[model samples]
Each structure stands twice: as structure tokens, then as C-alpha cells.
Target chain A: MTSTAAHSPFPSGRAVPTPVTGGRGGLLASVVGVAVGSVFFLFPIYWMLVTSVKPPSEWLTSPPVFIPDRLYFQNYTDALFNWGGLKGLVDSGVVAVSATAIGMVLGTFAAYSLARFRIGGTNLSFFILSLLFMPPVAIGIPMFLFWSALGLVDTYIALIVQYLTFTIPFIAWVMKGFFEDLPVDLEESALVNGASRLRAFVDIVLPNVRPALVATALLAFIFNWNEFSIAVLLSRGRVTTLPFILPTMMESHYVLWGDIAAMAAVGALPVVIIAFLLQRYLVRGLSFGAIRSE
Target chain B: MMATRRRPSRWSGGRRFALLTVAPATIILIVLSVFPLLYSLRLSFTDQQLLSLVPPRFVGLANYAQLLQDNLFWSSLGVAAAFALSVVTVQLGVGLALALALYRLPRYQQFIATLLLIPSILSSSVASFQWRSLFDYSSGPLNYFLGLLHLPLLSWTADPRLALPSLLLVDFWQWTPFVTLLLLAGLHALPASVFEAARVDGSSSWQILRYQTLPLLRRVIAITVILRLIGAFKVFDIIYVLTAGGPGSATESLAFYNYVQGFRYFSVGYSAAMSYVSVIIVIVLARVILRYMERPVGRPAADVPVAEAAV
Candidate 1:
């Protein structure tokens, strides 16, 4: 139902003709529109970069310095080393990687079962999909309390487990879609040749779904990395993530724009790059397999 | 080939393996999500305080009763509703327009769409900080730009009147691209044949869009709106960073208010009640959206053209 065959303008081995009606005026208008929109979308990112390099004096200038007069490389180091920024980044990284790895492993096994065996049938898939609709805040407070009672607050395990509530379901659903699209004959033939089901799955199905696995892991990592409310509620100063730290940084007695900008830029850089590099899969992942653009 | 000997054991073994594979995820989800839900529901009925030395006691409907009477709770709900409504409306409008424009410009479609998605992908906290600096009264780039344009520079975050709108602006900047991408995906999924037929019949572009494209896109649009609405309802990080729901709680959303109640004020039971109310609201919205999804698109059968209906 969500296949991109008809929607994708650039289908494999086929070229779609540009519609013939629009004239030069239309082309010019499209060009101008795209240019203006790109600037609007890109300006803040550009500003973050420029502001990160600007001297402290230029941060609050009357006519805001569009470009820094001198490069202040200290901002990056200061933001990273001082201000507890490195700790935040490290915490975020550890939680995200752990959650992604765990979710991927669990999801892959479950998805393979669901796809190949039709275990629990179609209603089960729908049930998993329903979990995606839940607003995180509804369960966030309770989970916070639960973690606190267990003496697990401010621990990586608490965040990773919370992250799994969303990621595992997502990975299961998306990977199920991917598994269904793969040819079943290869695995079946292997089974006929006396390979154990697990062995065949390990040797045959696993390699075929490598790309999907990577995409799912990347998307899950980004979600965990960018998550805030759970991180805020669950972690006190001990395991503060970048998103939680950014707000505290803003609330400091003296606002340092350069440091904030540098930290923000650095914090956002990895995910932004990953999103761009894996744009196609990211789009597919974002849609929850409802729009399989890939 | 020894087919019969291997078949029975293999079949049962496969079933057991499937069960084993799915068990861990199911157990984890239940422990994390379901247990907490039940726990919170129980907590909401008791007057539990994190900092207080008093033992918790079941108060039946007292917390819910208090929640209904609390002006702050009501205001936060109203703020959340208003915020969600406004943000979803603006994002839908602007996102649809941008999607349409990008659809028209086939050459730069991919590049521009990717560029526009940057904000949506960035951490909300990061985006909030970027906008917070932009909305800064004295030295912020926004006011400076307004000054250059010879327009009055308003205090964006500090003024109660402009605070919500300022936050909305930031939200619009961050999430409109998300809507745009979804709509674009929907547009791509549209059957090209219908548009071609409409053009062949000399239907105007506006007419084709209004009749054919929009009708076919009903489900996609509904899904996008529902997702955005839910997201807007849960908004916390941006509000926390940008205004901290400040100017005397003028911009406090339900989630942010609950966070404040539970963490800052240490009113555990009251916050659990608030979270349940938020969940109930989301459930209602989801039900309505699901109903819309189940309904047939466009007008009823009697109003349809016979030729089109035949298909």
C-alpha cells in the first residue's frame, strides 16, 4: 500500500518526462522559490557556525557581526572541555549507541519471526504500530518515578530501557517491512539443504537485510540522541545529556552566546550529517513504513 | 531426503524459536510501558508527595477533582490546546504550500527537500537555543534585522503577549519542514494518471488540485495532521529552553506544566493526575483521527458521478 513505485519521479531504469505545460517564466519562478526557501532553511545553521567562531565581544554587538572578524577556536574547546559539555555529549553517545544496539538485536530477531513465521499475525503488527501514537509525556512521569524507586535514576540503563519502548517497536515494524520484501526462496532452499533455521537465518537472511539494519540503527540512534524529556526527568546532573544541558546552559547567570553556539553546533553536527547522508532511508524510517520511499 | 522425519520437529522448533525471539521485546515493552501506565494510574488516586514525610493514602477521585478545579491546570490545558491547534494549522498550511512549490520544481526538488529537513532533524533543544538567541531583545539578530527594516523591535520572549507566538514561530521553523516532507511523500504517492486525465480534459490546475489531488491525499493529510498534533501536545524541550513557559505561565503547555509540577514542585500525585489527563486528551484526539481515517474520502455515494462511481 505504501510502495513508492508510482510516486518516485526517478524510478530505477526509467526516466519520467518533465511536464510540458510550464514555460520559462514558470522555470524562473521555481528557481527563485527554491533559492529563497533554501536560504530560509539554512540561515540558522549558518548563523550557528559563524557565531561559534566569533569573538565574545562580537556576540552582543549592535549591528550583529554577519561574519566574525577573527576566528575564536577557543569556543569549541571551551564548550567541549569546560561547562560540562563533554560529559553531556559522552552520556548522550553512550545511551544512544547502547539503545540502538539493543533495539536492533531484539527487533531483528522479532521482525524475522514475524515476517517469516507470521507469528501473532497481522493484528500484532497493528498493535505495535499503535504504540507509536502514544505521546511520551503520558508515560514519562510514571517511568521517572519507577526508575527512581528502583534506584536506577540517572543511569544509562534507565534511559536505554526507556528508549527501547519506542525504538524496538519501530525497528520491528520497519524491519518486518524489509523482510517481507525480500525473496523467501533463498532461505527456504537453505532450509531444504539441511541448514538449521537459526543458521540459515544467520547466513542467508541477515546479510540480505544489512542495509535495512543499518538504516534502522541510524534512525534509532538519532531518536535517542535527540530525545530530551525522558532524559530530563530520568537523569539529574549525573547523566545529563546534551539536550538537557543546553537548557541549563541558557539559564546560566551570564549568557555566553559563543559557547552555546559552539556546543549547539557540535551537538547537532553528527545527526544532521547522518540524516543528510541517509536521507532516503531516514524518510522511510520517519514514516513508520507507511510511506516506503526506498 | 528424510522429509517426514525432519518435518514435524522442524515445524515445532520453528514455532518455539519464533516465540523465543518475540518474547524479550514483548516482556520489555510490558515492563517499561504497561507497568508504568498502571503504576501511574494507581499513583494518581493517592496523595503522594516526593518530599513530604506523610505516608501515601488512597484519596479516590480527590486528585482528579482537584485537577478539574485547579485554574493552573485548566490554563495549561487551554494553552496546550491553543498551541497545538495554532502550530498544526500553520505548519499544515505552510508545509502544503512548500510541498506544492517543490513538487512543481522537479529540478531542485531533492536538494531543497533535504535542506529543509535539517531543522526537523536537529535536536529541539538546539533549535530552541538558536531561536532564543534570535529572539533576544537587545543584541539578537532578529531585532537587529527588524531595526534595519525600520520596524519596531518587540521583546519576543519577555512579553507575555508575544511569548506563545514567539515559541510558535520557533516551532514553525523547526517542524514545518517535517510536514512538508510528509506531504511531498504523499504527493509522490498520488496516482499520476488522474492528474493526467484531468489535464487532458482541460481542467484548470486549481480545479485538479481541489478535486482530484486533495481527495486522493485525504488519508495522508489526516495522518500528517494527527502526528503533528500529538507532537505539538507533547512539546516540552523547546518550551523549557526558549521561555521556560515564563512570563507567569502564559505559555506553559500540559507536558511542561506536568514536568514543573513533578520535578520543580515535587507534587508527585498531582503531576501523575495531570499526565493521565494529558493521555486522555491524546486518546480522544487519536480516536477522532482514527474515525476520520476509517471514513470514506470525499462525499457520500449518492453525490458521486456515475461514470467515476463505476470504477
Candidate 2:
């Protein structure tokens, strides 16, 4: 019956009661459960890291080397310089950053409206939710034809614009939830002082929700960085994103396993770092802000 | 309901401001969704060929007619449905159990939770690559471990019988943590007084879990299921990486088949029609789920008003 849990921004925040006193057996079961889960989860990432640093001789060998004796940078060199990893990294970064920037601006603006004015009510919100369910193929197919027609194929604009389809809705929805939970008094006071609504939103309301904004933006960035289907469909040779090109490396006849691992390691690095940084917001971000963690 | 409440100009300038702010994103979404759909619908009825010298000709429902008879279409639909169903069910069950176990832990809960998130954060391509090495036919660590135990070696992705299951295993490895994370948050957020009252009243642990925990966690469970099912239905990246829907179309999901039809063959009309059919299926399924999500789940004291206004 202690009240020492962390403070939460949620309106429903409460001091979590102590965990059920399940005694020694329960603690033992809990530790065992986590150990089992951790192996299933972390071992693959370990394999990826080990594979990236493995020499060519070790990569395809039977009884794959659990640990490489010495680190090899050749795979990393070939992946970055010879293959498209460097280009993929730059392209993916540009696209993800651009999309995240635009998405945050447009999505935040729309979310504020939806939260405060309840614009179009649940109908608008539902429409946005439905977009998330629409298959990427459905979007990708037509986008391919349209972009090809406009001669915009393999362009950053094509990928960024197409990314907006998902990003806008996702960011808008998550931020809307955050905005809805905020007290209206600060913004109202600003408005009553003859400040414009836009000014009030920018100065008073936005600063209050800064943490949520940062969390939502970072998650949107990760989503865009990891996007594949749209990238593959919209770009081929010119604007090759990391996810799009990794498969080509795999499908090539030679199949440089070490190089592929190196590229994947490089590609997955940013998102993993961000995930650690956003550990507190991990559930909220992944769940599109439907579940907030204390 | 208080007459003393100073109603801000919610009806006058506020509505206009809302419309102005929301219009750009809303219009963009509508245009992007509707135009492609209508254009794709138009293309669906025509024999449009991207690589052909022959011009497109209107084919009416010929594409749809052919789709109904196409064995690949039927099989791919079956694969996608089964894959989605299996992954969602397994992830949910295992995730819920893991959440319950972690919930009882008195320490190190946050550290473990953070570590479990590593897989979900990685892109699908990287995850697939990791699994590919693990599932390598002759030299994989999996077979090596199996060999140490004197067990028979199994070809993971190459064998037709094991291909889908292998994909499922990779998916389970990558995403079970996500489901677990959501459910754990839900568990942590639950008001503990109810459980206290139940225990004080002499309720057994099993009875408390069945009557109290499950019902309270229903909304979070539903959200987790819906999100996972949606991702599962559109599963393409992992399939493309792991199997390329290979071993003679044994692993081709609907999205993969659509890719092959459109990109590989340049059969634009047929692909467009297939896309529409899949969209229809998703829309229908989403409509049902969204309706469920919108319904009032029990809200706490401060949540009720905000929930009503937001919904």
C-alpha cells in the first residue's frame, strides 16, 4: 500500500500499489520467464553483430563461428563503398528526416485542431485510423504508376510525399491524444490576453507538450527510416533506400553474407539507439500513443 | 452543464480556425487515398501494360473474373489469412503470459523490459538477415546446436513445409516483445485497489485473474491484436527477404503476390484489380475493429470527460 511510484503526465495517474506478494516461488518463476524471453530476443541481434565482424572464411563455414577472433572491416568497407550502403544510408536519412519534419508540422497543426475544436468529430479521426489499415501495396501500386507517369520515379520528393500518407496520420493521431490530455487553461489565458490562436498554440500550448512532441517525432522518424514497401515500389536504382537495397544484395548470385550483415548493422544502428533513448516512451510510441507508460 | 462556465467561441471563430489548421493534412490524405483508389480502379478495368507496345483496352470485370479463377490468388489469400491469424494469436498468448510473469517481479523489471524492446526496434530487413544466418542450411548455429544434441538438422527456409513456419518463427522472435510491452503497460496502469479488495475478500489468485485482470486488460489486448493483425496482413519485407515467397509460391502472401504480378510481370491492370480486392478486405476488417475501439471501455474519473470529447 505504498505510494512511491513515479509521477505520470496522464490525468488518470495514481500511485501504483505494491506488487502482489507472491513469495519465493513467484520470484523464481519471474526470473526464469525473463531469462527465457531474453535469449529468444537478444540472440539474433548478437548473431547479426558477430556476423558483421566475421571474416569471409568464417561467414559460410559449417558450425558458424560463435565469436570471431579478430574484427574484419573489409565487409564494412565493401558494403559502404562497393555496394550501395553509403548511398542507402544517406538516402534513407534524407527521406526519413524530411518526412519527419513535414509530418510533425502538418500533423501537429491538424492534431491541435482535432484535439481542441474536435474538428469533424470522430469521423475525421476514424478516417485517419482507417488509412493505417490500408495495405501498402494498395498505395504502392498506384503510386508507382503515377510517379512513373510524372517522371518523378527515384526522386526524394516521391518518397517523401508518399511517406506522408502514413506519417501524417500516425503523428497526428498520437499528438492528438497528447494534446487532448493537456489542460486548456494556459492556452485560454493566452487567447484572452488578445494573443492570436496561432501564437497561443505556438508559445503556450506547444511548449507545454514538448516532451510528447519529441517522443512522437522520434518515433515517426524511426518508422520512416525503417519503411520498405513504398521505398521499393517508388525507387529502383537512383534513390535506393537501405531497406530496398538490402534485399538486392541478398538476391544477387554471389550473396556476400558478411557485407549484407555489415549493411544491416549500419542500417539498424540509429533506430536501436533511439529506442534506448525513448525507453520510457517505447510502449506509447509503438502503440501510437494508445497506451502511455509511467 | 454549469451556466457560470464561460463558453469560449467554440462555434464561431474556433470552428474556422480548426478548419484552417486541419484542411491541409486532411486534403492531402483524401487526395492521396481517393485519387489513387479511383485511378487504380480505372486501371483495374483496363488491360494496361507498362512494358507492352500494345495500348491498354477496357476489360471491364475481366481482371476480377480471372482473379476468382486464379489459383495463386486463392492460395495467397489463404497464406496471408493463416499467417495473420497464427502470428496474432501466438504473440498475444505468449505476450500476455510474459506480461503477467514480469508484473509479479519485485525488481529489475525496467531493465529487462528495455532489453526486450531491442528486436522490435530493428527494421524487418535486419531482423530477417539475423534469422537468415541462424537458419542457414548447412552451417547455421541452430543446426549446430541441434547437432550437439544429436538431433536431426532441419532446413529452415529452403524446405517448402518449413518455410512459412520459419517465417513465423522469425516474426515471433521480432514482435512478441512489442505485444508484451503493450500488455505490461496495461498491467502496470491498472488500479491496484480492485485486486487488494478481491484478495481481502478471500478471492483466490486464479479467481482474481479471471474475473478482474482479464476484463480490465481487454481494451489494451484488443488494440495489441488489431495492430499486430494489420502488420501481419501486409507482411512483405520479411517474406521478400527470407523466402521471396518461394519454394514454388508456398510462402507467397497476398501482398507478395501483388508485387510479383505488378512489378515482375508488369501486369498493371491485373495488379490494380488485385489491389482493390485486398483494400476492400482490409477496409471491411478495419471497420469492424475500429467500431470496437471506439466503443466506451470503462474509463476512470478524470478520463471520462476527455474520452467523450475526444471520441
Task: Please report, as a residue range, the 10-residue window in candidate 2 chain A with the lowest summed lDDT.
Answer: A10-19
TM-score, cand. 1 vs. native? 0.89
Tens-place lDDT per residue, model 1, B164-241, is 999898888888888888777776665556656777788765677678767776666777788788788888888888
Going through the candidates in order, their DockQ values are: 0.41, 0.46
Each prediction's Cα lDDT score? 0.77, 0.82
Please write out the lDDT profile of model 1 over residues A1-294, one tens digit for every residue: 123333456531113222222345645665576577678778888888888998888888887888777799888898888877898889999999999999999988988877666677555554555566666767877887788788999899998888888888889877877776676677778988999888888999899978888888898888889988778778778888888788777666778999999999988988988887887776568766544553
Off by over 4 Å in 2: A1-21, B1-7, B292-311
Clash counts for all predictions = 1, 0
In model 1, chain B matches the true chain B with a TM-score of 0.87
lDDT string, candidate 2, B2-40, tens digits: 211244553246777889999999999998888999998
